[model samples]
Target chain A: MKKTCPNPAFLGFLIATAILVAIPGLSYVKQRAPETIIPGPGVTRRGSLSDYLPALKGTSADTPVFYLEGKEPGGTVLLVGGAHPNEPAGFIAPLIVVERGVAQKGRVIVVPYANGSAISHTEPLEGSPASFSLKNKAGETRVFRVGSRLSNPLDQWPDPALYVNEKGQVLSGSEMRNLNRAFPGKADGSITEQIAYAIMEIIRREKADISIDFHEASPEYTTVNAIVAHEKSLELAAEVAMYLEFDDIPITLEQSPKNLNGLSHREWGDYSDTLPFLFEAANPFMGRLRGKTDETLIIEGKDPYYLAAAKAKRLNVPYDEKGLPLSYRVARHITAFRYVLDTYNTYYEEKAIIVTDLPEYEEMAYRNLGDFLN
Target chain B: MKKRVFLLAFTLVFAILVIANGPAVPKLAEPVMITTAGQSAGAAMMKVLFTKSNIKDFVFEKLVTADEIEGYETLVIVAGASSKGLGAAGIDFDGETQRVTALIEAAKKQGMKVVVAQIEGAARRGTSSDQLFSLFVPMSDWVIIVRDADSDGFFTNLCEEHGIPLTIVEKSIEVSAQLNAVFE
Candidate 1:
């Protein structure tokens, strides 16, 4: 008569353990699924980062690349976003370009998720949401994953004590996983470095005349809402700044520090013939002073802490009750992108890039951000 | 009749104040040589503005030596220090200061007008920037600075002590209009 009763306490513990493991495990697995991106009418070809670096194929480091070629052959403009996935606007800006932009003259190459590995994971201990949702023009909900500034530890682990990049610049070990800091990367290096190599290869193989990387920083950051340009691209950057200033969009124009190597703006310019530019916009969601980090904060960008910081004159960008929303940040990037191409066309008619049908600053900034999404 | 007389007197007083307080800025000569004392991006921005203002015969060199200013009538040394810039240019503060000093001395010897400009605002105003400003301001005939750069009246005090004309602009973007005005 073997009627054995199970221990209720042990059963309870088992149930609790399963819940703890299953909850995060499910979320982690769910994030691996790529977000749906519909190529617009302008998109002529769809490729992967693996195309440039075959080693990236079937790996998390690979990301989608959208090419919009015009009828008239001209220069190739490479626009990359989501280098740091925690910056949602960076990811969204390129998405808009892929979903809406039309290249009229030159070819437009867009990489919405530059670091696919990073895009699938959020920074630990930050308490950020796994993903955020926005309603597309069709009123269907589209989901986007918010991720860490560094590549996922699951993919690239074992941070060294120090990281000496390809440029011989010494940085903290954690920066090794940072795609932005891994520029002109090593082909046989870490996953993040390999991804960076792929990006550089894209620039080289594509013969990109102009390369722009989208980024976002906290409002308190001195370089927020600024355009950091390489030395070769200074004139183009200055012209873009002039046009932006005339439009009442105040942006700081900073030359990329030559000594601070391993950045998109610095390394891209040094390694390739492409004139590199990095654009930064204010994101309260990433600010140290922000409170209640959530999807709303990522989308609306309203943070009372940032508001107080603004009052204390601690912020570089002007912040008020009408917080720096994702729409505004994305709009700034798009506008700056448009201006760069325009200015490039003016100076280098032989390598001119003309991209049209992209959303304007006023249209995107003043309207619902989701309206532009697909 | 008394109201009209009062208004006339007020108007005359206002006119006199306006004329007295107006900027009696001396015109900057043509063929300006734009250079950076500390290799900041301000010089590049100034070049853009000069082009926008339609200023003719100007040359921009990040590290223009005294020899380079042979044809230039005015040496506009934008005074702003960037440590990264210095490191990139492979020069220390002392070397930069010495280089700038030599350039200024040569400009002075050539009878070229020396204009020290600080146009990147308060962000570019620091100890090294001040050192560059101090050394060059005394030798400068004019100082074109953003208003924020002079928030502590450092430029004002330096220009006053050296009898230099200081043009403080509210914004860096407005410097183009001011540059055009001075050229006019």
Candidate 2:
């Protein structure tokens, strides 16, 4: 009997074929980073966070900051999004502003993704999709990342049994990775804290008169669809709230607690001269009661269980079958930003910040968000 | 022949042992039981009992307490009332009023506000009418009552006689809308 030898050529071909077959599946595993927003006509310059803090120069936390400056030179306002990556409305609102807003009187600096590493992963235990897409007016689909609430564990691993934040807050170990909790961060800390420190450095260096941190919360949460303002920002927040109410958006103004340390509103105010404000839009997908945590649930913001809960008077936000769509939440944030800008102008005439080309809440709601996107 | 016989006997013993252990494993414990309450018109507005941190830990035994009263500055509460069992235990209606007073005092100290909720309809569990008045009415800072066309104006007139601010919410959805208006 003759022994047959295995063909090396055939084995190599088999290996190549296996890799080719996995290419498509592996592409899905790779995160879909959002398309870069081409700054509009109002954009004066673009800079990186590393410019302020060289320590974050080559790290994933270093994000591009868009600057829109007016010739008149008035107050400077800083708008940050993606403090919590799961809240897309927080990021998209500023992204839209960067691509569309035209500054007329003062300056507006927008950081679309404050925690870039957080956008690299999805929240563990929540089976959420990594990305979702929206169709622009020209029929081109624009994809955006649906990221985790905290920094990727790969970058910062083995959480302490309990994380005592810089503010001395004892929270779950995982919260140490949360950028929102790492505000006024230490320069020589973890990656998340370093990113936060970079942001604080930027605010202080810029002498930002006002800062707004955007976020979203579950509809079942009591603080949803509200503005949480630091004590110093109360008068401005009240004016914005009143204006929003008149516009029929119905936003509640909440005073930030003094004792809640490390929060963007609390720390930014305590550490810097900038008046800090945080906005929360209701997101049903983030709710504990939601079912089938997927991109549809995220973008469409619909859930049968939430509707039932709403009917039973258990939810904080109004839940109809129509659901709280992405466009509505984005519109809410955009409208609140406009109101805050207007309020800022009224309070400080010498340093008035005025911007145009931003859509009103109803206009955005009717035209849909894609109409505004570049 | 002896070696072949030994091998056959070992195979037979292995097969018997495998068959004795079944594939399906038995459960260790019974499943937990959960109870869900049916939806009612009054469900829209929860009659949350507001107590100071010390008393709240004891009084609002089963109800969820708002983290801070400022969370619900516009919330309405009915005052001078206790739960049925609580009222019958000689927790005086006057004592309930003092508790509400203490809560208001503490709220002011914390730079918060309080709203008194009124009860619209009486809940009847048994022959004791005090359960209806003691449990739901006086404890809320604000009162909301349900009045049908057949009530002969009894509940409405009584609420008005006490100078309580009352609103008639006929349907469950209406109650929700009204509560949203107050809280939002």
Candidate 3:
């Protein structure tokens, strides 16, 4: 009786539970591991965020920075993407540059995933996809992780119910994990703050003339298709807007307010000599009017709910049956980035920064973005 | 060859006349002052405008006074009156108008070219900003305004009626380049 075999139904239940558990557990492990990024020919060297903040050594907060330097020394421009990793285009734009761009006369530093901790998990309660696939011209499909806006709770736990930022500005407790709100960050602070501190340190250490943070906003948000520039950067940002407009890409420039502390646009300019600019493109999945929270909506940016909202004149951006594609949004950012650098070179004759092999705006809009990747 | 020489001569003379006859622009080489009616946003913008362009050469004071106006050959009266800014400046609405009116008179008396810039957008339009707009737009030789601030075509129509050269901007951030042109 003591050596009786296990019941058939019980064994079956156990087997089913094991399969179900293993399926997700394996996926979780894969997501937690760093995503593969093949550096392009232009990349001379690479470093981790921990180089700026040694405390981040061997921690999940560490991220890679791809360096593309020209033979002749000139100015440096810092490009940050994936500050809120859920916005897929923000990450993809910098990723494309790191994989395809080569500097012609200046140094280019790119942080494709600024918040490494955020990339380890999907946003909670959003029913977001774990990953999305991009097909290249060679018929190979590359799957990229869709990440969260906040630092994963596993890495940064126990919110303070409220957070006072570096500027002594109050924010929601959960916003402590938002990298965008932790700029000019304190080293002896939260993980998010430590990451922010590392970024500021990088900007100052590299002597970045222009520091840019790329982002995505909901279509209904008024600031979509807009660039928020610190006062010192408004001239360069306006020039970027002018060129984008001439290329049939309509973008507005908003002067970042002095009272709005802790934002990348505001804090970076104040804390460092780097002129700060934050660019935003429209993402339906990031908006409240989204029809579904899925990879299709994130990458394709086609949501019928946003379309209806546009018809009602509720959306700040133009929305139609032809949804704002991921390719278009990423192209806008890359093109804007190119023009900003162009204008910066024109204005600062002594610190002229020239870059080549950037993703062309038209090709990125009409062709496949993945084709540009290495 | 005779005709070509004559045309070339005409071009040279035209350029000479334009430069000799005071630039057809208001006070390029002389000092200009960006004076706010009562708004700090306008003042913040003026500071940025000065830094970004040659406007710094002309921008003598961000917030000018009657005494300060005498030296500035061009006076740009940025028309936006924020109560908070006024309170910070230690002026009531009535006091703000009196000081602005006196400053404008002093500028005009000093033969300074006047431009009123309603560049703070619509939020500043209907508020006490309108009182400042009323006094400055008609008196100034030129008017600069953000497009959204003139939703009812008030600034445009006013500029038209007053025969003031109007500069309409799609964004306030672009106002700096225009200010450079205005000073030129």
Candidate 4:
């Protein structure tokens, strides 16, 4: 008499909740597996970042490294893209470098996904697209993943109330997982720190003379379309700006603040002999003024809200009906990269860094970005 | 004793003559620093395109004065208007135009070789930037314009009509080797 069945209505509610929850959680788990990255003709050798720092081995943070070495030996350059995974141009720039770059007389080492764990997820509640598609030269569409700004808490969880980095610079708790802020890292530290440490190891092991961190910024940010360089890298950064400007790429130069701690440009300059430079391309999609966050905003970069802001004279960089597409941004980074090496070669005659076979800025902008991809 | 005294006197006189006339200094092609007369972004572009050349490319984004141009072997004026740039410099459009025009006039007065460049494409060929272009193109001894502008033969015809040596580059950077040739 005391054995009574539970309410069917309550069971029905429980089943509905479980079904709703399972669909999204399962999708998230499926997306956690890393996406495929195809190496191009330029990639002569490939390895994981863990090769430099074995601590990253068998971990979610280990990422791929594509190296392009020329027939003639010369200086080596390290290009780090996707430092912040939300920035698509930053990721695409290094991808293009690996896929299309021809090492003229020097070596170009590219890491398109510097933060392996970060790429597996998107920013929560942003309504961001998981990936965007581009038609390659053969007219076959290729997909690239878009991810969050920080390492997935699944990899590095429980952010401290305050994140005092290796250099004692206090940042918001979540910055503990920001690759840009964790650079020049400790080997046995958290996953983000280990990834950063691996990158520094790449610079040390490869003897990279120049290291560039690609980034993007809100159109309203004053530093948009600018190069933030270490004091030692001022000359190269300035030259790169002028070079891009000549191509109508609209580059400006900004010296990295000496006091800023735990930044890629600052830490790389302090910890190694490498000249470090960071670039911020203007992306209206990342701006607070953006409207309708979607794949089109990420790839095409056309936003009506930004156009209004431009008309109101509110943006730092130039914005018009044409919009700041991913092609334009990638072209800017490539042009700067070419000229920085050119100027570096001029100053250091023995260390002539020449990389060729990459698509030019005008062609990428006018023709199609997919034309150069494998 | 008399021969030695005469030899000493001859040597002393030769030394005096050499000291008074100064030593024969070898001439070298020195570097020339480049700066914008009105803080135009185009000047920065010109400097980049002029790299690896004997042009002695230096970019000074401030208003380049006649005093600074006195010793330059060649002066390159990148004629494009950036009102935003001028505004940042705390100067109005009229003032910047006058300052640029005066700097070029002064370079000419000093007999410094002048090459006016407007390699920026159609986007830079707007109203105010056009006025800046016109002010110096005719006055310059040589002209360098990007082929983008010469599609309709506007700049080439202008150069021909003004008897200025005109060069049309497929891309702006192509003009670097040719510019180095000019310096040579």
Return the top candidate by TM-score.
1
Q: Against the true structure, whose DockQ is highest?
A: 1
Q: Write the per-residue lDDT of candidate 2 for residues B41-75, one digit (tens) a residue.
A: 11112321111001121111112223334332332
Q: What TM-score number comes out for model 1?
A: 0.88
Each candidate's DockQ: 0.28, 0.02, 0.10, 0.07
Q: Single out the weakest 10-residue window by summed lDDT for candidate 1 chain A.
A: A241-250
Collision count of model 1: 0
Q: In model 3, which regions exceed 4 Å deviation? A: B1-31, B34-57, B60-68, B73-184
Model 1 lDDT per residue over A208-247, tens place: 9999999999887767788888999998897787567656
Return the DockQ of model 3.
Answer: 0.10
For model 1 the local lDDT of residue B155 reads 81
lDDT of 3 at A344: 87
Best by lDDT: 1
lDDT tens per residue, model 4, B1-184 = 3533553454344333321111221222334546554445556556655664456544444567666766676667777665544644566778877876787788778766677777555445556767776677778776766655555566766666776666655445555555544565
lDDT of 3 at B134: 80
TM-score (chain B only), all candidates: 0.84, 0.38, 0.79, 0.75
Candidate 1 docks at the CAPRI level of: acceptable
lDDT per residue for candidate 3 within B103-157, as digits (tens), equals 8888888888887887556545544677778877888877767666787888877
Candidate 1 lDDT by residue in tens digits, B103-150? 999999988888888877766666778888888889887788766677
For candidate 2, the docking band is: incorrect
TM-score ranking from best candidate downward: 1, 3, 4, 2
lDDT of 2 by residue, A1-374 (tens): 99998799999999999999899557545753545576878888999878877888877777889999988889999999998989989998998899899999889999999998888888878988878888777887888888889998877887888888888988889889999998889889998889889999889999999999999999877567778777678657755664564455645555566666778988999999999999999988888999998888877888999999988868756679888888889999999898888768766899999899988787876345777887
RMSD list, candidates in order: 7.0, 21.9, 6.8, 13.3
